[model samples]
Target: MPELNVMSEPSVRPPMTTGTGKPLSVTALRKTYGGVTAVDEVSMEIAAGEFVTFLGSSGSGKTTTLMMIAGFCEPDSGSIVVGGRDVTRLAPQKRGLGFVFQQYLLFPHMSVWENVAFPLQLRGVPKAELRRRVGETLEMAGLSAMSRRRPRELSGGQQQRVALCRALVYRPPVILMDEPLGALDKKLRDQLQTEIKRIQRELGLTVIYVTHDQEEALVLSDRIAVMRDGRIDQFDTPQELFERPRTPFVADFLGAANFLPGRVEEQTADHTLVRLDSGGLLKARPQPAPPPPPQAASRSASQAARVRAAVQPGRLALCPPEHGFCTGTVEAVTYVGTLVRATVRPLGGAPGDLVRLELPAGHAPALGERVGVTAAPANVSVFPDVVPDTESGG
Candidate 1:
């Protein structure tokens, strides 16, 4: 095995501000309400002109963190730095953040232009300047033509576009969005999703977005922070988060995963033999080098770090089919749009360990057919353990 350096920091973009002026940073961030901990010690830095997202399920602390950054909630312990200065206790308005919500939150009596102008008006900008600013924001939000319409007069998507314009009218440096598309239907939500990306990119705005939808995060963010129980469990670019998840929870949360529990049975120069508790032997490629002696630790640390990085080795499952090992009668099959899933009971598989294979729909083997299951090395993802490795063994 190659020497593994466990302390290397991953590459990340530096925090910066948007076109407006707001900047954001959180250090040792924590939020508590009575006895309940709503957010743990979360630290983040958002650079200017970057789009970052808080992605997780409800109660995962994504929204709470967003609220803290927006100055809507006070952190029990932590520092929020914006524009290179600490503003942990500043008022929301003083922090210069524009916030949007799932609901349109527009005034029923106001037209789109009036709604967009409201922020400028509150800031005491003159009518002439406010009108110009509102017009610019309306155009940015693709709502210039609907500027005269009331919120009720627009479709859900149009109302949302107006809300976005209102949020941007004052041109705050950072925009905090809390599931802003949640209230829209699927088609409208998808449409607005693209629009949000385009607008954020074109204007070079710093955006901190919150969403429970994984696909949304994948599509919208340059990077994602996955939260669990008020703490950030992982933060990385979406591709790294998906293809090389550092934890089982992240892997499972992102998509369907087949977890095969196992133990290292033996190790050789080239491979580690892992014995699956489910009764199969898996061949895993070894790290390129082994740890160096203590006296040379520092000299070899960097080299070891590169070798210890996660490897994208292919995984295999024993089953009856082309390249599969275990043979069994098909128990059930379900046809989805492009693929068919087959549930089969292998000779040694536990009740819950029944294997599922996704094949092209029309080519599915019939139910009750005796067949073999095969896995291509590249089709499988091998984690050192069913759980994340705390120390290097792979």
Candidate 2:
């Protein structure tokens, strides 16, 4: 990549929470390929300079949505506005955007300096400016010492850094990263995660990063857009997404959740009592009046949460075998890192009654020991049963 010998001093500012200009907004974006709708009416707002991640499993249309925003895949309908300007029809190059793909996409025969300089050269920048820009970019990527190195000479992390420097050499306001760290090992991925965050912050670049890893999304994003079946399931900050998912799909996708089927039994001033079909009554913080009927109901858990009032009206339906819940004896235990996982049978009649609990391994519980498990009422969620067809929405 071409080295960026930056003549201009770019200020490293605080990570952006809001757009310095108007927010980047996508309105009713839709794309269809033959019989499959790749991206279906996806709409979201990305604050300028904020790192927003599109996270989903394969074939979930996250890549399609990113491509549409980059103008590589034209949307059949809807609009993309950046900093208040509608750029739905703009060419990818003309949009002043930088993109880094999973494969690095560097010319193997080209020197690192040349690779970094390619963007500037494409823009018809002066030779002096190109050299300066590429040199500075190389330094920013921590590769000034290896400007002549080929892709094969560098580590996977370093190669991706070169790709990133290539994307940033022009100092574009927006950057798109498509699984740039996907191929790296766990340690390198962790290292580059910090680097990517630092570079994005230092350059004040608005980023649309895509990945299927929930941990990556949580660690890196100011907000996450969870896509499913060509549509956005939910969009929220990591904390909000984890704590109060608007949909069952969002809750389940972000982490392990316990779901129970229930119906609104009564609404009081401070709580809504719902009767579970699984033989339990659940209390939930009262939702707004005229709340939408519970659809695809589910609840997320940090660990095995206890329901103090759960057994009042009905039996506990499902509990994670990792968190201690259920009335049966401990069947087995597995120690993993700082936590120990125990499986128990709440109902002795079936083998599947195993409830898992996550507890400190320092003072591990004994096997075959009968233990009582309880989770707070607030931790449990009461909702309608899930549909058979839509089992995995997250």
The 10-residue segment with the lowest total lDDT in model 2: 306-315
Put down candidate 1 lDDT per residue, 47-135, tens digits, no spaces: 88778999887788889888888888888999988778787898898988889998989998877777777777778887656656666
Candidate 1: deviation at residue 255, Å? 0.6
CA error at residue 92 for candidate 2, angstroms: 1.8
**Predictions: Cα RMSD each:** 12.6, 6.9
State every prediction's TM-score relative to the real structure.
0.78, 0.80
- C-alpha lDDT of residue 355 in model 2: 50
Off by over 4 Å in 1: 1-23, 266-273, 283-322, 325-330, 339-342, 357-365, 369-394
- Candidate 1 has a TM-score of 0.78
Instruction: State in Å the error of residue 219, model 2.
Output: 0.6
Candidate that would win on lDDT: 2
